[model samples]
Target: MEPHAPAGRLAARAHLLAAAGRPEEGLPLLAAASGTTPAQHWAGVPWVADPTLGPRIEPGLLARTVMRLCTAVGDPAPATTVTSLRPYLTVVRHAVDAHGEHAMLLGAGSALARRLGEVRLAVEWAGRGARAQPSKLGEIWLGYAYRSAGRMPEALAALRRAVAYDPDDLSVYADVAATLADLGRLDEALRWTELALERDPDFDCVVHTAHRLRHRADGDVEHLVALADFVRDHPDDAHEHTDLEECCRNAAWLGGLPSGTPLPAGRAPVNAQPSADALHRLQRVSGPAWPHPPGAYDRALGLVLVEPWELLALLAHPETARAEQQDGLEVWACLGLLHHGTDEPWLDSSRRRLLLGLLDGEVDRVTQAALFAMVAYAWVDPEAREDVAAVVAARLTETASGANARAVAELALAAPGLDRPTRELAAATIRVPAAPRQRGRGRSLLRWRRD
Candidate 1:
C-alpha cells in the first residue's frame, strides 16, 4: 500500500470533488472505486508486528482525514460509498490501543458508528476509547454512546467521570441533565440544570434545558413561559438556534403540558394569542396527554402557533409528519401566509431563501400543493409568487385533476402576481364551476372555528 501514493487516493480525490460542488463529476468516480479501495490500510505483516504502529497512516493523520472526509461527503448521503471507509476503523482502534490517548480517532469512530446505527459498536468503541483516555472527550462520548444504547446507569457513571475531569464544562452538565431526564429522574435533572443556570443564566443551552426539564416534569407554567421568553428574545442566537429548535421540540412532544396549567407572568410574542385562544377553544378531547402541536407547545407565551423552524424540520424529514384529521399541513402553512399582509417580519431574507428552496427542490405532492396554494397571497413578493405559480403550473400539466384541486387553484388565481400561463393552468384545475364566495374566510391555513 505504501509503494505508490495512498491506496485510495482516487476515491479520496473523487469525494473531495463531490464536496467541492461537483457531485455529478465526482459521484461516479467515488462509487466506482470506494468499495474496492482502502484509503489507508495495514501494509506490514501482522503475525509479529506491534498493533499500535501497524497501519500505513499515522493515527492522528488518519483521524483528521476521516473526520474531514466525513464532513465533505456528508452523513446519510453517499451512504453506500462511505461504508467502504469502515475498514479504517480497525486501523484507528489499533493505533489508539497502543497510544491509549487518540482522542480524535475515538471521536471519529464513535460518531461514525453512532450515525450508522451501530449502537453496540459505538458503545464498545467508546468504552475502549475512554478506558485508553479517560480524562479527554472520550469520557463524554462514552456517556453519549451509553445514552444512545439506553444504558442510563453506565451513561450516568461515564458523565460523572466527565464532570470530574472538567468540572466547569457546561455541556457536561447539560448532558447529565438530559440523561437524567431520560431515566425519568426529572427532579435530579432539574437540580443539575439549576447548577448550570447559576453559572450562566444567559447560556441558552442550560437555560432552555432547565426550562424544558422543569416544565415537562411539573407542567409548570413559569418554566414554560421562561422557555417561551427565551425563544422570543434569543430566536437567532449565534450558535444555538438550531440546537434550541431541536431540544425544545423534543421537550414539547415527548413531555406533554397540562391544558389547565395557569398562565405565567409573561409572554414574548404578542401575535400568537389568537392561535392559542383558537387552540384552547377547539381543544381536542384526548385524555390527559394535553397534546400540543409541533412548535405550538408554549401557549402561555403567546407564541403557540406553528413557526418557521417547524417548517424547516418538516421539510427535512424523509416523510413529512402527518395529521389524519387535518388537511395537508405544509399546504395549509403556505396558504396561511396570505394573511401576513404584505409585510412578514419573520419572512426575512433567510426565510425567502427557505421558501424559494421549497419551490425549486423536489418536494412531495403535499409540498407541491403548498406551492400552488401560496399563489394567492398578495403579501408575498410578486416575483417570488410568480416563480411558485410557474412551478405549480408546470406541474399541473402532469397531475392536474380538475375537480378536487379546483377550490385551491381557483383561490390561488383570485389573488395577484400570476402570469397568463399560471392563470390558464389555474382555470383548467377548476372543473367544478367556479362559485366565488367571500374571499376573507377560507384562505387561511388554520382550520379553527375562529377561521
Candidate 2:
C-alpha cells in the first residue's frame, strides 16, 4: 500500500459507517483524514492514465466523500458545520460544470435539500443534474420535487418521461399512479397501479396506493382488509404501518365507530355469481353516463354489478360482525351514496356531520375536501352551503400552493347551493398568486414554490 493509502481507506470506511446509520462513529475518522494532503490521499490510487489500475481517489470521489459525511450528520448539525460543508457542495457543482464528471453531485445536492425541506432548491439542483446528464435517477428526483410542490401536471409529465426512459422502474409507475389519483382520475390511476404491480408485485408503494385508489373510486373495504394483513406480516415497513393506520382510522370514522377499532385481517374471499336483474342493470347503464344519481337504486346496483364483491360485503354486514351495531349510513357513504332529486334527512345530517368535522379540524383536509366535492351537488341548504363555502374559501386563502388553492376553488365551484358572496370569495381566492410558472427551456425543471 502507498503512504497515503491509509487516509483513502479511512475515508472509505467513514463513508460506509455513515451509510450504515452510524454517522457519529464515522465523524472522528473523517476528521482525522481532513488534514491529509490531496497528493498523499491519492498517492496509491491510480488516475485515468493508468488503465490497468482498478480504481483511484479522484477529485470527484473525494468531493463526494466529503458530501456523504456532511449528509450523514443530517440537517440539524451545528451552524458552523453546515456552513463549512456548503463550500464542498459548491466544489462538486463547479467540478460537474467544468469537467462534466461527478454528475451524481446534482442528485446528492437535491436529496440533501429535500431532506432539509428546501423543496424549491431541491428542484433547482435536480433540474441542473438532469440537464447535466439526463438519467432516470435525476428525472425521479425532479418528479418528486414537482409532486412535493403540488405541480401535479408537471410531475406527471416528468414521471411519464422517466417511465419512457426506464420502463422497468417500478417506483416511477407507482409515482404515476399516485399523481393520477391526486388529479382525481381514479380509473387511470388504478390502471397504472395495476401495471406497477405487474412489474413488482410486492412493492409497498404500489400496493398502498392501489388500495387507496380502490377505496376512493368504489369504496372497496376488501383492499383495506388486505392492507391490514400486509401490515401485520411486515411490521418492519414503516410505510405499511402508516398506510394501515390511516386506512383504519378513515374506515372507523366513516363507520361511525371509534377510531381505534381493530382492523380486519386477511384477504376477502372471491365469489362470482351475479343475479339476472343486476346483469340487466349493468348492461343498461354501462355506457358513458354510468355514474348516475348517487341514491338511485340503479346507481347502487350498477356499482355492485361492476364489482360483485361489494354487494356481497354489504349484504354480509362485515362491520357488524367485526364491531357493534352497524350504521348502514356509513356503508352508503362509503358507496358514494348521494341524494338525488330530493334531499333526505339522513343524507343532510350525515353531510352536515362531515362538513362540521372539516371545520373542527377533525378530518384530514384532502379527504374532507374530496367528500365535499362528491356530495356538493346535493348540498342545497343555504346556511349549510354558506358554512361549507366559507370554510373552503378560508382554506384556499391559507394554502400556499397553487395546486392546493386550485383544488379548493374547484371544490367550492362544485358545491350546489353557494350564495353569491361565498361564490365570489371562492372565485377571488383562485386569483391569488401561489407560484410563478416556469418559462423558457429547462426553466420548468427548477420551478420553486414561493411563500
Instruction: Tell me, by lDDT, which candidate is best.
Output: 1
The local lDDT score (0 to 100) that residue 157 gets in candidate 1 is: 89
Cα-based RMSD of candidate 2:
21.9
The models' CA-based lDDT, in order, is: 0.49, 0.48
lDDT of the structure predicted as candidate 2: 0.48
Question: Residue 324 in model 2: shift from native, Å?
Answer: 27
Tell me, by TM-score, which candidate is best.
1
Q: What is the TM-score of each candidate against the true structure?
A: 0.46, 0.39
Candidate 1's displacement at residue 69, Å, is 6.3
Candidate 1: worst 10 consecutive residues by lDDT?
262-271
Clashing pairs in 2: none
Q: Residues 304-354, candidate 1: write the lDDT tens digits.
A: 244444433332321322244222334334333332333544335443444
lDDT of 2 by residue, 285-305 (tens): 322111211212233433433
